[model samples]
Target chain A: ELGPMIVTAAIGQDTSLEDGDILVVTQKVISKAEGRIVDLRTVTPSERGLKLSIETERDPRLVELILRESKSLIKIDSERGIIIAETHHGFICANAGIDQSNVAGEHMVSLLPEDPDGSARRIREEVAQILGVRVAVIISDTFGRAWREGQVNFAIGVSGIDPILDYRGSLDKQGSVLKTTSIAIADELVAAGEMVMGKAEGIPVALIRGYRYQPSAGGVAYLLRDPASDLFR
Target chain B: ELGPMIVTAAIGQDTSLEDGDILVVTQKVISKAEGRIVDLRTVTPSERGLKLSIETERDPRLVELILRESKSLIKIDSERGIIIAETHHGFICANAGIDQSNVAGEHMVSLLPEDPDGSARRIREEVAQILGVRVAVIISDTFGRAWREGQVNFAIGVSGIDPILDYRGSLDKQGSVLKTTSIAIADELVAAGEMVMGKAEGIPVALIRGYRYQPSAGGVAYLLRDPASDLFR
Candidate 1:
């Protein structure tokens, strides 16, 4: 649905995805296309969800959905009314990346796509087949940081691009060996793409051209920090 | 120094900073302009610096500078050789944001700008006077996240633009009342700007055009989180 729909939207708007273009798409539209929208009115809270809802002061049914989506909870600060959970996809985010905003109605909440990397690959293949142009796709979602205030969009899915620009062992302009300078390129590009996407205005996609990224099958999994090295965890 | 040099460089390159354009300048160049660069050979390690250096397996002279620049140590994982400290500017980063990359030589390291927000304002003012065009300026630095791998550029200094966009209390298109959806726009824009900047190539500045950010005097201080609310600390 996403690959065809995105192509249709582009053609309808008199634009085309050029060769070597990176299409940054929001995760909301991808989830919607995958029928991940859930109605809170139809949900019932489990015992643990009910207790957590009371502690966090959230809707019991919504908490149930979040519990279902998460593989483990990292931080449960009842005082701050926050639950930082490791989602099924190994992403640690608040409320398991579930949100009611940008959905159709108040009772509607969307879950993250079942397989975000696969979702991106399918879109890339279909787009290439239809237009005969090679392009990369990224699925982005806004997530809060640990010490930083507010949220910025991060790459949750990727296809046809190496996620990180590994600059370790590379030489700088001054002939100094760069150490530990691998940049999270997919995350940066997604955050860049989010600037053009009007969040409040419901613009879910942005076209980023002219950036020459290393093509690789190594998906967003590369962006997730190894738990052993992560000090905060 | 940054203001004049940046303007001169723009003229040299025959590029003009247009109105509503956000200029993203990396912190390294600003520090270099401000004489924040230090030769590791010139520093004398203190008693505490020597002890910490051995534990963290870092250069004693470099550790001495990091200790002096930091207000407090947040995390010290000797096993990982990672020291997360709160910089004087209130940024929590490794080695208090001291970096040897992008500088003249391996012996030299760049400290973060003393007053990042003021540095941004100076660039904005000088660009306005030279080109008669108003522009927002952001001083950016690459930082590692707690749960994520690699680093994305963040706004450590901001001028002529509000660092955040608060969408709380606004009605969505579905007529639902949104809550707690403030975005760190300055950080996102910096990451976007980093895409064009060749890190290994030593390109320190990037220009972003056509983003309608709200102009404000609220500096990057707004991006720092209150320690009381931060769960990681």
Candidate 2:
């Protein structure tokens, strides 16, 4: 029961999950379903974790979990209480996407799913089986960007559609060769989904209807740039 | 009109631009209206600009414009032909947010407004005056993230509302104290606006109604992070 569940049957009957629709599932649900929860009572903080905990003024157990989930520590801003870490899954996020909010117990926290793309694909397949419809799936997570303040929902995982709608080499309205116009449709949809699945609201899954997208095989793997190509890291 | 016109009147009458509404304006229209368009023919490439042009395999004239608009060049990926620059307004974007597509002429490229927050405030004031209603205005631009591929619309400027809805110290569904949950409402709204204003569809302005937000004094300047606080740059 802790693993991923096929939630198509549980969704409201009035809502029609149809073809050409996008099913935006929040990462919180996926993490819960995947049993990615960690109990603070069980965590044994390492020396490094304890050091960081003291530096960050956070719980040593929480710091241990963050260290376990993170591949590399990018930055530690104790004044701001923000730790930029590269998660084991290669995501650059605050605290390695280990979140303390919305869990059942106060002592427990949820980690991002290990393979979010795989998780998305499985969910998409299960939903397709139940509904007999082709729909894109996006695993959405809230993340803060480098230069911008505040956090917005981003597509941590994607399935059934290409995340990017590449308009490069395409003709603009004036027939100009378009460049630098590849739209992150998944991320945009994630942001749109957040409008419906509010932070305080319990709506974990949102149906984005009427929007059409090109079918694709891969998930959010292509969204990750090579280390050589990334200037920020 | 070579500058951004308060376009509330031009928007279709069918769409009621009402109070508590968010008007998302694409930066393309704002830049065009603000006369931020630069003629490539007129640019005289400096020695550094010319060197960067050859290294980045771009037009020297365009490189000069990029240098002029940028406060600092963050990173230059010569192999991939990408220049990550901190714009004069402190936005980290490719080519310093100088866009080539969707402009009137092939020889012309649009520059990000010197004061996008100022531009948004003026537009908001003008729109409020015309409609006799208060509304939030967001100046949106598409930007590629440091780790992720493709581009999603971001709030380059905002007016009439605080861009962030901070949920820190608030109770979650499970009564847990939520921290690190500040939502970037403006950027999320920008993404929603993109859903309505499709690229190449020529729709530049989108009116979002029914969503309530807190009225605030400042623009998107608050969204810009201090360089010392930023780890990615």
Candidate 3:
């Protein structure tokens, strides 16, 4: 059986974290605290924007923000209401990570926090100073996958944890050339935490215990693929 | 820190699974136990197969098996060495879920177990009967994602866990409706377990504890997406 649950809040201030403790803060809470919400009513849509809305099968206002956030539009399928774009951070995700859920009002949506790695670093520093123990911070959001059944939460920003486990040079039991490298450990952890922190439960945080992950100097940025090296594009 | 490690192997037999205990048997173990491995030397590559591989940039021998396994070929990318086909079980994955890794010797790979869900169910039932506790069994493999950085593991077969968590009809804190909802928790779990078990670590299975997951009556088959409803395809 799992241990008892501990609930806490940011309370407009930083809270310390401990080892084996998983911080499961909601993206909405982080955006609200960081002032990342954008008012949709204040923005104006263009003719190109209206065309994109019809092309993407999304709201015109939402498509306008998505277009602005996008550095490159990879694909747009009007029938499926799907638009894959490269974000400013070089992350290729749907809608450029612009989201309508969990905003304070109807006419507003929140963009992913600018420099999530930076946010995670700041939180880690604050928590370490207060609690005198190390902890890993994962900022998560829901994302769709290609050729999969449903959406799953994944880590957008992470600190104090190695995001990818590279096994390129390692050998399997049979000693054959094992090129199965780069496992996304951090993203999976965020998805696991989302199981307990339900979408509608108002529980923005979850504490994870019993597993110890290996520490690495490499940060979450390593998980971001360089577009030049990407063969699919 | 995590608890002590545990591992189990079914040497000539496919046994049932138990709670908190992981079966470390290889895909070859299960395939051999189920008699699914095909001896390529026994078969001949057809004239049409040779012509198609020249066009598809696929190994003729492998393509022959893939065509046999696939109900239909959805898409083919010769440049990227990818072929998306619908498997007999109606799964649309790369190469019809035929893998070329971790097999017995050179020039041999394994087809996905004939009945993955049934295999998982049988293993779960037998393991429970032996150890007297419920356990989740996942048959995993590495698959590349379209428009993503690196390959991640996904559950090709699963038991004793709900592959997708449906949150439809649920309301957010602000009373907003959640439409088009479900979380693919089991696939995420399989991916997470791969992080620790790893391809080269000789840890084919890792016992996970301290995480509580609710099972669904539909089991892992519920996670399979219908081709008509798949937006990305």
**Predicted model with the maximum lDDT:** 1
Off by over 4 Å in 1: none
lDDT of 3 at A215: 60
DockQ per candidate, 2 decimals:
0.82, 0.72, 0.44
lDDT of 1 by residue, A1-233 (tens): 78888889989898888999999999999999999999999999999999999999989998999999999999989976899999999999999999998899778999999999999999999999999999999999989998889899999999999999999998888888888898999999998887788567778888889999999988899999888988888
Runs of candidate 3 exceeding 4 Å displacement: A1-26, A54-58, A206-221, A224-233, B1-29, B52-59, B73-84, B131-136, B207-214, B217-221
Cα lDDT tens digits for candidate 1, B143-201: 99988898889899999999988888897767777787889999999998877886788
Residue B166 alpha-carbon offset, candidate 3, angstroms: 1.0
Ranking by lDDT: 1, 2, 3
Q: Comparing candidate 2 with candidate 3, which one achieves the higher TM-score?
A: 2
Error of 3 at B216 (Å): 3.8
Give the TM-score of each candidate.
0.98, 0.92, 0.81
User: How does residue A129 of candidate 3 score in lDDT?
Assistant: 63
* Candidate 2 chain B lDDT trough over 10 residues, lowest sum: B1-10
What C-alpha lDDT do the candidate models reach, one value each? 0.91, 0.83, 0.67
